[model samples]
Target: MNIPITNSIRHGRRYRQQGMVSTLIALIVLVVSLLAAMALMRSVDTSNTIAGSLTFRQSVLQEAERAYVDAQQKITFTQPTSDADNAPLGYYAEPQPATARSAGDVPNVLVNAVSGSIGSVTPLNSTDNSVTYVVERLCPTSGAATVTACIVPGASLLGATSSNQTSDNLTPFDNGAYAAFRLTVRVNGPKGTTAYVQTILR
Candidate 1:
């Protein structure tokens, strides 16, 4: 005896196989899409963090520069160089020699001024930036005693020509003697950024 399979049964078996394959493809696509979305979000977050840091650094630098200028404006040559007793509230007559650091280096002060006004301490801004400054007269000694000791031109000084050429001429800088002072500013921004600025005014 021999038996033959029916066409309808064969067709139904084929349709079931096709449906299973379609379901598997959909699941795979969903997983890939989820992973891509997550990576994209992380990239965006990283970019935002870097941008915010740069903004903070810029803000702090600007605040520090302002303090440096302010310190110069508030103090004059007549002011004392050292106010050891009052310190921060008063301008230093002679620079604390320990803090007499070279240009671009932090001043070697016993007490670093953060804020408030005694001498050169800058007031805090309405914004988050906090500013402070120190003014140091460029002389080895403090008070009027060192007045002549300061850099004063006698009769000869190498003068600058319009061409800006240097000469060994021994005329003693004829220009009027000018005493210079240093202004150092420290700025603290809202985002934990710090900046230092210094200028020498004659």
Candidate 2:
């Protein structure tokens, strides 16, 4: 019969397919390896970006502290005038509110500190990492202790003016009036990094 010839042809084709099977498997393995390498590279890139951001934030924070101290010194020693205070000096008796985004903040100088744009605030440095600061007396405006939010110890309070050697329990306090001052600092650095810092002192 012709059956033997047909069977031999079929066996030859199967043998050819077996020979190419290894090549097909090798191609699939190569594709998978390439995908894995790409994924690993992307993960590495993301990690690097995060680390860079953290480093930049820390640097800007240090710069902010310097501006805060400067603002506090100015508050303690002298009053800032419109003439002396500007973009470079960062000192202001009044609060500047952030206009674009208020969130639920009350419309006041204190709220302005959080919601308003400081506008080219006083630059602390000449470089790109320059910082700025503002000083505000806690009161809505400067005035007398009765009219303003000043805190002062009473003269009749014990230990206000007592000497360590004095056994007098009736000793009165003599500390002068003190007012709270708030300092706000901002810094702009490389990579669009920005930071804000606030400190309060009396």
Candidate 3:
């Protein structure tokens, strides 16, 4: 009778140990599932953030383009004659190096705009965003847009050898001499977005 009672107690202990092991395995599976869910959620959040940033960047770029067009229109209509710094009108006679506001560098016109002295701040009626532009003549020095000082288009076309024409005889674009101008447009849009757009025109 004593031996039978001892064997029954040992069997009971073995069953309890097996149950504990099963429970522990189940808990581990649950933890793994939870970690996977968290990782997936974080990936989704990162994707959404990237998408939003791209959209905003595109919008600001469009604004910059519109500002560029506005600057071009002003140059076409006004035909400013002075070969000097016309800060009030956002025009520079000499060429400015390609600078970026986002690169910890400041544009000359922005300083003017901030000081309330001179700058062309054109507001876009559609988006209610303000844009600034600087029109710089591509010239070595400022007095006039002469051939010796200014950059003109079709330099390669001027001296082309087509087997029939010599470099000196070839006339490019009907011997037209036009000074190239650089238009730099900066747009300040919603959500603290800034963009720079530049184009060369003749």
Candidate 4:
């Protein structure tokens, strides 16, 4: 009878040891699974952030391009009108009432032009990304040009007389026009990222 009782006690002890080992293994697995889940979450978050930033950058660049195109069209349609009191021959004239040919009722157009000139540094979106742009016109001149100049010696013609003429130090447009205008756009992205784009408008 005593031997049987000792055998039973030994069996109970063995079962408890096995149970403890199983519990330890389960706890270790749970810990490893939690760690993997955390890492995956972090990776997903990082990817999302990158995608959002790229999208914002593209949007800002597109907006800048639209502004540039609108300015070009305005200049083209207005037919190079001189500023009030002939201040200077700027690419963009002052804001005027909407016409049928114009982009009509687009307040953002004026806002973009003003912001670009004044370095207003307005954001592309409400999420802290921003862009600033500048518009400049290159007119043929004889001397002392402000932004860019194309001057021909001994010729009274402006932007003409290519022979012996001083062309703009800047690269001319692909169309080979003696005079062309330019727009410079600078984009600032979140987390200190930035990019620059320049386009020529004739």
Give the true-structure RMSD of model 4. 11.7
Candidates arranged by lDDT, highest first: 3, 1, 2, 4
| Cα lDDT tens digits for candidate 4, 1-202 | 4355888899999999999999999999999999999999999999998997778667667767755655444443222232121112123323222213232222233234453333334344565656554444334332222222332233333333333323555333333333434455556666776555655543
CA shift of 200, model 3, Å: 1.4
Candidate 3 ranges with C-alpha deviation above 4 Å: 1-16, 76-82, 97-130, 154-177
lDDT of 3 by residue, 1-202 (tens): 4456787888999999999999999999999999999999999999998997787677667776776666655543122363566655667777554444553334565534544323455565767666777777665666644554456543332232112222443222232334556667666666666666666554
Off by over 4 Å in 2: 1-8, 19-24, 73-88, 99-128, 144-176
User: Which model, 1 or 2, shows the larger TM-score?
Assistant: 2
Compared with the true structure, the alpha-carbon lDDT of candidate 2 equals 0.49
Output the TM-score of candidate 1.
0.51
The C-alpha lDDT values of all candidates are 0.54, 0.49, 0.60, 0.48
lDDT of 1 by residue, 92-170 (tens): 6555444444436465552365344334434455666766666665555664423344432231222311112223431
Model 3's alpha-carbon lDDT is: 0.60
- Predicted model with the maximum lDDT: 3
Which residue pairs show backbone clashes in model 4? none
Number of colliding residue pairs in each model:
17, 8, 0, 0
Q: What is the lDDT of residue 39 in candidate 1?
A: 92
Question: For residues 1-202, could you state the per-residue lDDT of candidate 2 as single tens digits?
Answer: 5456888899999988987897899999999999999999999999999998888777767776677666545433223232123333444443345333322212233333433333233454444675655665433344332212332222221222311222232211233233344565556675666566665543
List TM-scores for all candidates, in order.
0.51, 0.58, 0.65, 0.48
Q: Sort all candidates by TM-score, best to worst.
A: 3, 2, 1, 4
